[model samples]
Target: MAGGLVKYRHLSRDSAHRQALLRNLVTSLVKHESIHTTWPKAKEAQRLAEKLITLAKRNNETSRRRATGILYTPHDLLPKLFGELRKRYLERPGGYTRVLRTEPKSTYDQGASAILEFVDGPKDLRFAMTAAAVARDRALGRKSNELTLKNRSKVLRYRDNGEKAFDDMVKRIGKLDLAGVNKGGADKSGEAVA
Candidate 1:
């Protein structure tokens, strides 16, 4: 009735409930950048977030207090948010928030759900650094595997040559002939036959 369709009273019908809902929505938006809720709540959250961003862009004491009062964020974080983030988005106009529709909930009045989130800045440098570290580790692992294989092959070659050396020694020692007679057969010195 107030803003078309059914508005989410969230049980209570007082100003406290509205303020509490707004604070909860803002906190969730800041922490996760997205939240799923009923359509009206999502729309309300989007409107609130846009206003907060506008105030953040202003970067003044009055604006900070006003935004903090509405969103219930910590006063300490306001300076950082305004000083750093505000300057970054000075060129941009509005549309600081986005809403997306999600699956409908089966229970709790079967309300259709949607997600609200803030549009953040570009990709962080740490992500690229982490990727580089992973690639370096993978390369090192491959090199270590290759080195292990080479060492194993060298050990196997040594073992094979050692076996061949033992076989050569046995051949040089020759076989004993116990069947021969002891009375100097053919050669008196008992030398082997040519």
Candidate 2:
């Protein structure tokens, strides 16, 4: 029945090549806090990224060595990974990385693409999306829906001073011309255009 089969995507690469590719991806992810790539690659990298974060959280010699082995530029990234990222994710239990499917980034490659990012970081996509939703709801004079409410909670759950951050984002988005109000700086209700 193949009940205990070890499953992993090969991504059309030999073992050594695949390992190197994953290491590079994880290194970039750690440096930038987010990365965009093919869905399969992003999914595979997410596994390694989660493990790296777990290692950082441990903050021990063996864990640091293991993480260094996985990362390409350990010298440049180790401090950030062990210090900032470790502290950032210390409170969370699991699910450190998120893979969000996106349209193909290039016309040549029609394959599914995605963005891989760490949760609760400054560049969290879901957080910005949730704040935008809240702003739109306010601008439209409508209450937030159940899904929006749930997403809001998820975005704010682990964040420190989440309410303040969310309010700030909503205000920032509100200042933009989100709805039909004053489109293109014409001021739709103006008496005349000079």
Candidate 3:
């Protein structure tokens, strides 16, 4: 069994706890459109969340029943799940969710962290990041690099009038005085500069 393929991470929890945990994560994801958690839990919950979106896309009785079963607050979420999310991802085939890794929340905790999010929504991190990249390049009087160009195209691929939205975001971010932004008055050395 040492060389055998593993199916999924157990996350040191038994089956019931794991299911409930994933259900809660997915429910919160539906409610908020994004969530931050430990990387393994994000990965596992991403799987279930994607399947639930697929069910929502299907928009049939069986799929609705399954989605209801998976979500903790189905009464509150079923409408958004079956209506808004369905319309949002209708044309896309798969990959509804994304997982981006991050540093641990604090120095004392070293577990790998990640953000699990539904893409193409109002709170899309990729879209915002790509727009920032474009704005930065423009502010520097330089053309976008290959990676920036690729990300720009990718983030704009699905949304309605994505180009316009990207342009608007770029314009808005371009107007910001990034040099004046600070981390709670802390400068490079974590000393007060305000």
lDDT of each: 0.57, 0.90, 0.89
> Judged by lDDT relative to the true structure, which candidate is superior, 2 or 3?
2
Per-candidate total of colliding backbone pairs:
0, 0, 0
Q: Report the Cα lDDT for candidate 1.
A: 0.57
* Residue 134's lDDT in candidate 2: 87
Q: Residue 41 deviation, candidate 2, in Å?
A: 0.3
Order the numbered candidates by lDDT, best leading.
Answer: 2, 3, 1
Clashing pairs in 2: none
Pick the lDDT winner.
Answer: 2
Q: What lDDT tens digits, residue by residue, belong to model 3 across residues 33-108?
A: 9999999999999999999999998999999999989999999999999999999999988999999999996679
Off by over 4 Å in 2: 1-6, 182-194
Model 1 stretches astray by more than 4 angstroms: 1-12, 106-108, 120-194
Angstrom error at residue 23, model 2 = 0.4
Candidate 2 least-lDDT 10 residues: 179-188
lDDT by residue (22-119, candidate 1, tens digit) is 77887677555567788778887777778777888877789878877875555645655577556655655776666767778666677778767654
